[model samples]
Target: MAKAFRTVLGERLRRLGKSIWWRHCTAAAFLVASLFVLPARALDNMSFVVRGGEDELTESFRAASLLVQSWNDGLTDPQTLFAAARADYGRLVGAAYAEGFYSVVVRIEIDGREAATIEPLDAPAAMREIRVTIEPGPRFTFATARMRPYAPGTQLPPAYGDTKPAFSTAIVDAAEAGVDGWRNVGHAKARVADQSITADHSADTIDSLILLEPGPRVRFGQMTISGAERMRPERIARIAGFPTGETFDPEELDTVANRLRRTGAFRSVALQEAETLGFGDTLDVDLVVAEEALRRFGVGAELSSTEGLNLSGYWLHRNLFGGAERLRVDGAIDRIGGQGDTLGYELGARIERPATPVTDASAFVEARVGREELADITLDKIELSFGLTRVLSDTLSAEAGISYIHTRAEDVTGSFEFDMVALPVSLTWERRDNPIDARKGFYLQADVTPFYGFNMTDSGAQFKADARAYRSFGAEDRLTLAGRVQLGTVVGTSLAATSPDFLFFSGGGGTVRGQPYQSLTVPLVRPSGVTVQTGGLSFAGMSGELRAGITEKIGAVAFYDAGFVSDDAIFGGNSDWHAGAGLGLRYDTGFGPIRLDVGLPVSGTTDDGVQIYVGIGQAF
Candidate 1:
């Protein structure tokens, strides 16, 4: 029995060995076939040589840098760098170098390191310099731009198409215009893809093509709002951007939704779009909300030049009485050097109702007392004020209020005490260009304020206008220019001996990047060893920026800023002015441009100051 079993096992082992050998042989044959059948492509090449003068080297280096910036990878290898120069040189050949000059033989030296050389070979004395002439291509007229439905809907129709023109030489322009039209129709996520532009030089004709994809059209379906149990559903819905009969826009929806969430109304607001709708053109919406704790506490600190050695503490009630009302108490102490010292405390509250749409309003009241000692005078005052503000439109608003004040003025010689009342009215209008993705747009603003003082105090009228324009040179570069002018005049028979110390002033933080606040002010009298305060004139702040993106991430900028406070009496009328110019580096953050600008005074102050600002969104 043992012998028979051994014989069977031996036979099986021999069979297994034969099977393994066959498999190995087959794998070897497959490898050989692959090697013989595949094609061979070269990934490396020989280096080239270039040599020229310092001037030529400088120009050549600039050209090389531009080429490298445009390239996907900034090639540093000697051989690869040589190849790049050779390719660039081919484009320069026969091209006009100057009025009577042209490129001859451009070369690169790559023995140890990469260096480009340019040669401006002179023609024979008998041959006049050849000035190459350039001819403009055929002019293609712009055509009509229209938007068609991406999906069926009963909402508003798109409103941005150009009805008159007939041809568009640039497809990007047409496609962007089409998208703008969709935005007007309340479609915020609208986009154009597969863009193509065709222009026939012989026919002098053009064709613009694009595919429009309007993402989704949503509406206010249902909601479960709880944190504000004291509030009504209809009220919150209207203020939340999903008004009844209102066409859905992704941007508006996103903005208002986030605002509501930030209000600490609910622990969480879960929003989703339904899969189907009763109306073929409508989108069903659903909202699930959870309530958060009604009250909370927090504290924060920041550094600033204007406040000077300041510290603040505060406590907050997120949802006061479960009614979406916000209450906060804060205290602060400030010690300023050379200027003076101030110590004050304030209590403020914000109350709101979720149900009101256009009428929904928030009222705030604050009371404070402070003592300030300046070089010429000491001001100690107690003030109380309240205001009611409303958001009339998405970007427009108005506020009105009244205040009561008691003040005592004193100097090294004497002191006096007085009480007064103030009634103020203010109106504002703002239009944000591209609130969602602001690549190109313009913002316009106008603000007017009128105030009245009781018992021969002080009263005046103030008007301010600000306008900003933004333009993209192409996909990556942008040009932005902004100007703001503020003017105010005191006009009351009961006005006190002088204008209020809190009147509008320029030169610091927001007005000019580097100058100290109100440094532009000029005086008619030399008080406190500084300048005297002459009558005020028109205040002008103008800034211009040119930003070009070499790639999607890196960019460079050149900018100029000029500002002036033209006192009606100083320098015979419009003389006090300051101007600065400089360069900047920018990193494109998806939200907007993250900028760091290095500026130097050009004409006014002797200080070579630098300004750095970091925030979310555009500078304007």
Candidate 2:
């Protein structure tokens, strides 16, 4: 019985081996067939080469030629290659004209024969090479260039009538300047009436005559609003602040469009001028806006060695009341990985009304409640504030507010409760080209808040000023130098009597980063022979950074920060200085740059060897 079973098993194994061999042969045959058939159906392999031009000129010709860009992988057939080569001839000639080569010869060859001479039906079965050769003739110089009927104060470029190469771009630029000169002075209907250009191949010179018609100076008549669904038309007009009945200035139109967009209610805003002039030398402007969705929400997070992890979120309603009113609610929690009891929380809400009976002005009301436990203090606070903000210009603004705060605090000095009322006012001016990553400009802000405590005889005024400047050098602003100075002082009362929140404490991410959070403070000696940090009454901080962009999306920064916290209302003999130096890495994104900094204390009291901070945006 064993012998019979062995014979049956051997037969089954042999059958299985035969079946596997047949399947392998079938796959090999299929692969060989595919290799042979795919090539016959595939597109022809074509190569493009640009000759007769060198360096930037060669690159410019290639960039301008559509045929060069269209032949990405290869051409489908000889017919497609012929079509592409024919189109590239005109593009190459135009590119030469733009570079002051009025007389240029462009030749495209396919497989060693001119493409233009070949008939479509006689094209080769497969194309191997496409060659474009350019003969850029003698460059032309501007011999005579003139523009007529330009506004009296118009300024044209120096190359307009010089012996320099007569670039086509220069002629267009001169015409634009003539028209813009009129638009700047209230002639909104100005346009280029006629252009006469002649290129002399024999003399290697070009002559250009551009005539501009500055239509009669007009005034702004009215503004018609469109694309309003949830927002009111009247509110849109009010917020835009179009200067009606005033001389028509193109800048005013731009200002109106920018203002409407800044409200965050619109996805797009356009101001279109009437085609024909209106009666009484006036032009009616039309404002077309596409509104965005009403609600938006976002969440953000940050990490710090001393403060632990912070997480925050916000919700916004763009048109909460149909008048472009904005409402926002936000909350945050910090110190998530701390010593279990040092968690901090905050909740706040704000509502804003635009165009509050004044041009470029808004009113807002806000309320907040929070609890915080720092290194040497624990505090709980509730606050309410109402404010008016005015936009004086594109780069300047002012704000004034009244606030009430109730606080309960505990420190080494024991626990205390106080109610305070304050009147805060501030003015800010900023001219940075980019707020998130400033390359150049200056910023200045000054603030003053006077407060009165109801629980004790404490009345004082806090004054603070911040000034920053940014300057860039090198190609594409690859190197940026930024500096900032901050000054603050509390007057009219002692530090102990003032509200703890209003007092100044240095040594945190916002100040001297290498030290522990709020670790640098004035020492107060108690009767029990123990001294503790009790915050400071006056403070001054200075920071400077040298940021160098190593690549398009990568940057490195070296920074130094110094701060002083004083026991008196101003700097005195008892004041001490603390400093920190650090290097950082930045990765730029669409919204802003991701930042990581490692800081080390160079002066003052810092027990931690090194501190690290990770967040979005610049430290400033």
Instruction: Give lDDT per model, in order.
Output: 0.47, 0.79
- Candidate closest to the true structure, highest TM-score: 2
Regions of model 2 farther than 4 Å from truth: 1-54, 71-80, 118-125, 339-341, 453-457, 472-479, 525-531, 548-554
State which candidate has the highest lDDT: 2
TM-score of each: 0.50, 0.86
- Per-residue CA lDDT of model 2 for 410-484, tens digit only, reads 776677787889999999999998888898998999999999878763888999999999999999889999999
Candidate 1 per-residue lDDT over residues 255-356, each given as its tens digit: 567656746667777666555543534555665566667666654332224334445567677666445666766665543331244443334344444323
